[model samples]
Target: MTKFADIKGFVFDLDGVITDTSVLHGTAWHQLADYLGVAWSKELADGLKGISRMDSLEMILKAGGKENDYTPEQKVELAAKKNTNYVAEVDKMTPANILPGMKAFLDDIRDKGYLLSLASASKNAPRVLAKLELTDYFPEIVDPASLKHGKPDPEIYTKGAQLLNLDPAQCVGLEDAAAGVQAINAAGETSLGIGDATELGAADMVFADTSLVTLANIEKHMA
Candidate 1:
């Protein structure tokens, strides 16, 4: 087992990593599509993962053949409406939706004195964290609002590592999106891709979901 002896921090993507808000986001997208008279498919929504809501809305509208009809202002209005619906939907999130093993894994890392932070593309990240009551676990959070570029750009992940006072190679990034895996890889950090493995080829390691993420597994890489 390889040990990352120099590693001092862990950076996680908020949506699919710490919370199950991906489902809510997908539902919102579907609702938005239906409202626009388009058939919503998981295949369509999946392509927008790890992007900002604005970008996702643009992609969705384009796919639905409404790009030209929807002005930027209108897009913002629809996106805001979707966000409003999403927030209401996810208000049901509890400690149970924190994934099967995330809390324990987070606790283990904190207990071991690792600096923890979040790098997420979601604008609703802070709200979701607060809703899940996981805000205390992370001292720093970088969202799309904090950067000019989103995932696959490496900016957010790099910024997150910098905020933790750690080099990119001295941190581990956890994400569930292909773009996020690519971003972490481009940032020159070890990345553990979670959720669907097929979309995570750029990751150094892959786990099916948060259930598979454990301190032991991380320690193995650190060894």
Candidate 2:
């Protein structure tokens, strides 16, 4: 078993883990789909989780049989348009938007001297953190804009570990998306899932949501 004293840090995925921005993202995608005259629903929203902006657009396009109709440049523009809508929604956000059990949990982690970082694929991570009054909790926020690849690629998680000066195996990653969990595990850390059990099947240990990923359970993964 991995012991508590052996772990060096904890890295968390943003969006669903830190706050419920999934709905905002899904709304943006739905708006894009509406503009494309494509029917959008939660099922389509499910495919957007943990994916890049353009990738989500492509998925929606493919569902509408228009994936190949647009050039890469056009796709980028469309994705940017959708992001504008999401940003407007995010601007309305406040600190209460922080997810349940997160503030106290993060405080406890810091109190225990465990290095904490945020490894989000969102280019607006810093903005969101500031809006939620969470900027002080993480000194190292991996630059999502610098990533050529997103979750499930392990690049973000690896960068977080590097920024913290910790080995991947000596860290733990918390996520609410299957792709994020996969990225965490691929980076050699314990992947703690924070969502539906069936959806996060790849995680080392799955919790229903942020509230359930208790410190006791977290320490159990240390080695």
Candidate 3:
């Protein structure tokens, strides 16, 4: 039997995994931080990865010692502003923006008969996939609006497995952030992190980048 014999589905995180829209997200957040008179840093931007819009906003506010400055209503407006900026950038993406080897990896997984689903914190996931013309590859995308918790909570990853009609243990969750990897592991899925190994040490496996995320590589590591 293959090393992934029991795995029936693959759950993917958007942003850094399927495409390079992370910079777009960062730009949007930076714009919002500027509007709020908050100083932004690369470290703060890094912490926002794999987290929800509200969560990211909250973190940014706290980093600037302005967490209590905005009322709940103002926070909502700020988040909407950020999303508006993000969607504007996302609108410019094309299929060519799909990460190296990611398109081929999706094709290969589908050809091999494994189900595919997405578990993204971004509300613009559908738009992003559509922009990249990769919607058909993922039959299910767990709705971020339906979840009560975000990454590092396991709610999203667990919902992803349910959407694929599989148990968490029977699925492989791919992510490029520490929070996402932690969420996948908490959900009982085999976690594959697609970035720095040390940063995503919670994952069951780690690939340097999407270009290295081939069936052969996955199986070789699992074996």
Q: Which pairs in model 3 have colliding backbones? A: none
lDDT of 1 by residue, 1-223 (tens): 2257778899998777887787888888888888988778767988876666888888888888888997778888998998888988778677777888889899989999999989987666777887778889887988566798777899999998988999898899999888889999889888999977677877888888788898778767556
TM-score of each: 0.84, 0.83, 0.84
**Model 3: residues with Cα > 4 Å off, grouped in runs:** 33-75
Worst 10 residues of 1 by lDDT: 1-10
User: What is the lDDT of every predicted structure here?
Assistant: 0.84, 0.86, 0.91
Which one wins by lDDT: 1 or 3? 3
- As for candidate 2, its clashing pairs are 2-222, 2-223, 3-222, 3-223
The candidate scoring highest on lDDT is 3
Order the candidates by lDDT, highest first.
3, 2, 1
For 138-208, candidate 3 gives per-residue lDDT tens digits of: 88999988999877999999999999889998899999989899999999999999999899988889999
- Worst lDDT 10-window in candidate 2: 214-223
lDDT of 2 by residue, 70-146 (tens): 99999889988998989887888898999998888898889988998899877888888988989999999998778
Q: Could you tell me the lDDT of residue 83 within candidate 3?
A: 89
Residue 86 displacement in candidate 2 (angstroms): 0.7
Per-residue lDDT value at 147 in model 3: 96
